[model samples]
Target: MTRAHGEVGDPPVGKYEEPATPEAAADRVEDVLKLLEGRWKLMILFQLFGGRVVRFSEFERAIPGISQKMLAQQLRQLERDGLVHRVVYAEVPPRVEYRLTAWGQSLCPALDGLLRWAATRGAPAEGVSDS
Candidate 1:
């Protein structure tokens, strides 16, 4: 019942810690960044977002320059991390599909904000401390 990231300007609510020590805050952010460490993981997740359920082969077509082996590996890792849900169906030819779990979908707003911030692409103002 805790949120991945709260609404902008909203005070820390639910299980969120308030004014965490800088060290603890950095550590927590680092943990989230680690979840997206792999090269194709983000791309794969993006494909599964938007309520789109993608078949195994469809991923190959969606993401260029990714090998089938690499695609499977990334999907498996995402699934293990509880971010991607995989469904398999028995049929004439076995079928598999991938979609983001609610936890994964919750990342949309945060990532959308990050994307918009990145689009700004400007240097920090003069005299701003790195800290």
Candidate 2:
């Protein structure tokens, strides 16, 4: 079966394989960034963090400016990436919910580290100007 990124039968989900060189490491990190390269993806991920099980309509309400189609697309991508778990209930109207998988939950600290790193950029470098 074909998987995300078009690799066939690559079954190591959430397993980290250390890159051989620093440049390779950089490339690997950038690849992960590519999976998250959308306006609403990060917002959706932030909502899924902290073990929250959010419904489709709730996501619509929480993330302003995102259309229904965009939300569904983003969620599907996350699910395909093994990040989000989707659950559907057989109720009157058919309830669907989304939450983070264990591997997805592991991203909390990495994202938190990113947040800290961004926060630590006190000012521009010596020659850089904010203007």
Candidate 3:
């Protein structure tokens, strides 16, 4: 059977290689998980997935219960991780906006899948309150 480009059964070519050991694979997984380890990161990414540039104050208003300080900190972390791009405009007020980078856009499919699974299972989607 022919495997799609990144499917598990696809053969590794070029720079890519199977992990030397299962422990090495686990470590790689841990590293990625560590990057995304936070309450706000996923939600922040979800918001950016709407394909529009978002501003600092916009995030504050969209996400309930998120403080200004926390939102700033999380956006910084995402930018450092190369997932989110921050554009600062030179102006009196210093306008700033955030959007997902190409690397970050790659995450949309996986996130969409997770959302679909949650819906099928009757679980609440993000931003939806059970109450």
TM-score of each: 0.80, 0.80, 0.73
**Which of candidates 1 and 2 reaches a greater lDDT?**
2
How well does model 3 score by local distance difference test? Answer: 0.78
Residue 128 C-alpha lDDT in model 1 = 80
Q: Any runs in candidate 3 off by more than 4 Å, and if so which?
A: 1-15, 116-131
Per-residue accuracy of model 1 over 1-131 as CA lDDT, tens digit each = 22221111221237766646988888889987887889999899888779998998899998999999999888877777767877767665777778887888888888899998897677675688779
Question: What is residue 19's positional error in candidate 3, in angstroms?
Answer: 1.8
45-86 in candidate 3: lDDT tens per residue?
989996878988889889999988889888888887778888
Count backbone overlaps in model 2: 0
Maximum-TM-score candidate: 2
Q: Rank the candidates by lDDT, best first.
A: 2, 3, 1
Off by over 4 Å in 1: 1-14, 123-131
> How displaced is residue 109 in candidate 1, in Å?
0.9
Candidate 1 displacement at residue 113 in angstroms: 0.6
